[model samples]
Target: MSPLRLVIRLTAVAAVAVLVAACGGAQDPDVARVATGLLDAVDSGDGAGACALLAPPVRTELEDTSGSPCAEAVLEEDVGAPSDTTEVEVFDTMARAVVGSETLFLSRFDGRWLVVAAACDPVAGKPYDCAVGMP
Candidate 1:
């Protein structure tokens, strides 16, 4: 093969690789949808709706709390709105979202995604455990 032709081929390959890397590594939209639903539920003060969107363990915990002040505290926070800039990491049937200062970990169960855990702080207050609320 001619040296010039080889160079052209290599450049084309490199360009294609860059384009794929840039456009193909996007996070799944379903994950974002789950995150948005959870956030909206919380912001709207829909504890039942939020609980419905929680994984089993977290739902159980929330239920056992029996309407504690912890729930109110979570509902009161100005955690900010969901944004397109949120980061998501997806696993087999689970995902985590980092939106602003809050981090929500979720799971896909029975064909729906539900939040399992949410925490704004690592050391303070009751971290909203969504798994505890599942009935």
Candidate 2:
């Protein structure tokens, strides 16, 4: 396969593995708090705050995808502000949160868990398809 396609396939596999690991596992409290903070920022329309909490790559991807800065695109993202911060699942520095049916993925940096992806849905027998973030 092409190099780019190979990378995409690998990324998809990793995403699926992470989500699968989250099933029936213990959720971390600190991770859950950070995830909630992100959702709260989005719900409150604090675009800058939400953008600040995104992982560097996620922010970069948002800017690239929107052709605008994260501060601007974060608000304009079609994925609605997340709610129901429950059933959080953490695997080392990476985490997944259930926010009103959408899974929000996070990673830790500088001792803080920043959102790596949001508004993700796993297609049965396929990789996750995310709306507002990247793998």
Query: Candidates' TM-scores?
Result: 0.58, 0.72
Residue 16 in candidate 2 has what lDDT? 93
> What residue runs in model 1 are displaced by over 4 Å at the alpha carbon?
1-26, 67-81, 122-135
lDDT of 2 at 100: 68
Alpha-carbon RMSD, candidate 1: 7.3
Q: Highest lDDT, which number?
A: 2
Residue-level lDDT tens digits of model 2 in 1-135: 999999999999999998877653455676667677777887788889988888888998999988998888888764445666467777777788776666778888888888888767788999677777763
- lDDT values of the candidates? 0.65, 0.77
Query: What are the clash counts of all predictions, listed in order?
Result: 16, 0
Q: Candidate 2: global Cα-lDDT?
A: 0.77
